[model samples]
Target: MDASHHPCGGIPSRLPGGGGAPRPDARGWPKGCPSTVARERIRVPEATRRVKPAAACIVRHNYYPDTHVRRDAEALVEAGYDVSVVSLRRPGQAAREALCGVNVYRLPMQHRRGSSLRYAWEYTLFLFLAFLTVTALHVKKRFRVVEVDNMPDILVLSALVPRLLGVRVILYVFDNMPELLAYLRGWSARHPVVRFLAFLERLSARFADRVIVTQEMPRRAMASRGVPRHKIAVVLNSADETAFVPSAAPDAGRRDVFQIVSHGVILERYGVQVLIEALPSIAAQVPGVEVQVFGEGEYRRALEEQARRNGTTQLVSFRGFAPFDELIATLARADVGYVGMLNDLVLPNKLMEYVALGVPVTASRWPTFLHYFPDEAVAYFRPGDPEDLAAAIVRMHRNPASSRARARRAKELYQDYRWSVQREVYLGVYSELLNGVVGASAMGSRVGAAPYQRS
Candidate 1:
């Protein structure tokens, strides 16, 4: 994928291929760099001046190497939209950069943990920087759309200035923010801050020109919160098939004895505790059933302590956060991949990624999983039920043939979630916005085939 060539419309003079040296991304993550995940291809006719080039500005608080955002920007660019992303600094990113044809600007900040002071400082700084970026970019470029990837739910404000400038704003929600924070803190909605956040969330949803949610439950949740059903679109959080390709089966010696893997944030909301509590029974029933827990989060320490207390610390290993290839390789070796969420309004992205990897999954019996895996591809265990989780683990370990069969079935189901299809749906949203198509059913009809809406 050459950054020089536009996938959809004729090349613009501003793009590097037609002019002087390409603008060096201040962030180390450079555009068209081999190290970054490339966007999936989707064909759109070269956009002419008849349609104004839509400018997309993404506002995200916490950052990851998001392939969805990358592909979303790429699709808009291919369709002749000028793309600019505004996000907070992650570990290795520079303050600014151009990535695979997208303008990415980072707000610099000191890393802080869970202190209220830190949260205030971070959000305040992000808000200030974001407003500056939006004002500067809009003055020079004609951006007609602003996209907010929700985790903090504060990104919806990014559209305020743009809307005042007559640009449309789309809120792209990946997780249910209020519920996620409550899950993380183990606090209930009764908490004052939780209540305040819920209020803010409802207000944000109301302000968005269009709302996008990852799962059906969140879409319903948004509607319940007073966001009209017609203003929302169900856009799922998906893995880029371009990055997580299937690899050759590993040599027997290279695989764990009784391999089990779980990715994403290893936190309580993910039900890592159930896996922790199941470890002792699983170890006794199937000796040397080593478990590999990937990603880092609040629950990591608790899980490690539980393993130690149960005397199964030797049997469990924490791989922390691995890079892209290592994470995929780890997934490829998993005999039984785990997926879970504390009954939330959104599905976990890992469920789709694991399924795409063709691994037999043992997931919590939640509406989110049920929505995705109606087939026997996913083996259900009672949510937070350690005994049930242990039994499910032992069953898969005992029946390798059944596990492999489930893996094959899961892969077949995941075929619908290919990046090409996902990119097209996203582009449709941008096209709708650029063409002044904002309604209950923008773009004429819903993207019914999105795998995130599995049911």
Candidate 2:
């Protein structure tokens, strides 16, 4: 009794609308009876007929609560795509969870600072784990796109399986690895290690269907280094305005203590030591001036010791790693926000956060900062010079009216780089990539018309 040869098998011969059984046809079955193949071709239920959303995955070595990754993932979720993030997991965090509509799968590894070999081992482990995780997820969820955020650049290779399956791949370059390595290790660009990093970067960029950079500087850097201009898109690291809005309180600016705040990873290259060194002079000029440092990193102990040596330990408080809401409240109440990075290659997100919150900024006069912020919008100080920073802080304290004006100007300038505006640009990049129209000329046209001016 093979079902294929049975006239009706288990299926009913009569249609739903009939009042009586239908008459048999020449084949000795009811007229208009559906054949086995026709039965299999019945219409799907209306509820199940809707199109399934395309799936997207973000692969980064960092842990969750990463502002950039979270922002991008949530944006994709909002755009009706099913988004998943594969990232490092810290102790006490769940291995898998849904956050703000984005599914996050945390690997059982934590990032640690260490020597070159140690870093290599860690990256390799994460790369292998990522490769396995993405491949498995794609088999189940069928990811249409995979985006890899790079530190080693070659992490983009983890998506090889997905790319081979015709999934679009994106390489999001947060830092130029070669330039950063050269800057951190005092290596020349022509050094063998630096050249190797550059080669890896080019390979990663070529492997990816598209490359995304934080700003114009990196976009140009990648292009000049032989990355196809059309393959690159500029999506800035602007502050999320909803979380960094100006305080509505009338007394938000009326602080009894003149507090200066700097928040982010405390790295020497970021020049937090410069701010601490300038504290004594700043306190001398502006009485009761308090410097609040909110963040934690390898440089925290060095900065603390520097503060003690400068005899301004009492004035500078190390409030390490406050929650995002707390950080925003502190920024709102602060009299001035500080960004003291030592190089032009780094564009500090804290600068944009300060501006987004309408806090007057005192930042290093690096090319990257200057390109985005005009002199009138920020009180500029020379890089690594405590004396100049002290003067800049003193000037802000002495002329509150002028500082307020600069803050207003900074807020106006921030309108151009606010996440609200940049989110669309980011989504457009995805749209282009998914549509298979992402090209050098198309990317160039979009970037050229973007709010940020070219460097």
Candidate 3:
């Protein structure tokens, strides 16, 4: 878990002090020291020496501390692969650092929300920088696999050099770009620009040796777009249970107030406004009802205004982005977790985290939500309908026993998609692609298992 910072964009040629044989650190410096300190001779673990050296890199457009990217990178490290993540450099973050056994190399660029042209320019610039960084890292690390997570699906092109060098490339589709674009731009799916994104998506998928998607819906979406079905694998973004523990029994002191929590980027499509609109009805039915909004984004200002206009300003509190542990603590205390997305395609990770913590959830009845959570496990409301959402919340508040029972059911259903189970599935994708040679033993008896073939 030790991390060392480097100011340079690429791997440092040598440590700070004069030369000696580079030593392996706890975070796995396979060839060279990740730290800049003087080298010293140290005993390498037998397991480390016996295992075939496999290096992998993940290229993501976001900053470090990204839950999905961190989970995947750490899983690789645990499976005996040296993992590195290439991402954006946010303010006050190190240019290069090792975290939780994964080495992170952040570029100089920052992510900003703006017009389509601005987005295009930023994506293009990051793509170019990533290509250069990955090419340079491969020269030293010789990564056996390069995985790219997408906002712009074409980021997979950053690995072109490595792909040409016989390294396996994986395009991990976090979201269906075309569908997201259509939703954000209010354009028809058949719009020329949306269709162009679909074209790029297909090309990206075809370029990768395999594609990893969050769930079955996106996998099917990719397959229908001419990306071969077998080439795609589903890796659910379930909560890391070790960090997100189930809440202790309800406190009698908290019974005076109904606490509802929703956390994630505050975008219009996420439907936070719908939740705010429902707050008045919820408070009227269940007095002392309070809503905690966590995380910040472009739509926050408008959401605050809407809360004020609805006369529910006191009922709703916007608690901006908090640390992971703090967020989990907040979720654990909630009487209900709210997911009010207008879009049906995304399976929100926040929903999974809520379930993981044994928090009762009232979620939008999106196809993706229904696909994952059975009717008995969650109380679902019509998406973007304030009245239905309010009714759902009131019902849960009035029927505490039913709410807890439903939460229990959710925890049970979550077992099928929790991180431990999905991590193996994720590693299996790499194992299968590498011909069952790399990390095959980590997959245990499922070594040759067909890469998560569940439809």
Quick one: best lDDT, which candidate?
Answer: 3
Q: Give model 1's clash tally.
A: 7
Task: Report RMSD (Å) for each prediction in the order shown.
Answer: 8.2, 17.8, 8.5
Best by TM-score: 3
Model 2: lowest-lDDT 10 consecutive positions: 1-10
Candidate 1 local lDDT, 134-211, one digit each (tens) = 878878775667887765577677667778878878887766667766765778978887888888888877777788
lDDT-wise, the better of 2 and 3 is 3
In the range 130-195, model 3's lDDT, one tens digit per residue, is 999999999998888899988779999999999999999989887787887787678998999999
* Runs off by more than 4 Å, candidate 3: 1-52, 246-248, 323-326, 436-445, 448-455
Cα lDDT for residue 173, candidate 3? 83
lDDT of 2 by residue, 299-417 (tens): 78998888778788788888875544456777787899888888767577788888888889999998888888889999999999999999999999889899999989988988878
Ranking by lDDT: 3, 2, 1
Q: Please list the residue runs of candidate 1 whose C-alpha ends up more than 4 Å from where it truly belongs after superposition.
A: 1-52, 64-68, 90-93, 185-192, 250-256, 439-455
Q: Is candidate 1 or candidate 2 better by lDDT?
A: 2
Q: Global lDDT for candidate 3?
A: 0.76
After TM-score superposition, the amount by which residue 348's alpha carbon in candidate 1 deviates from its true location, in angstroms, is 1.7
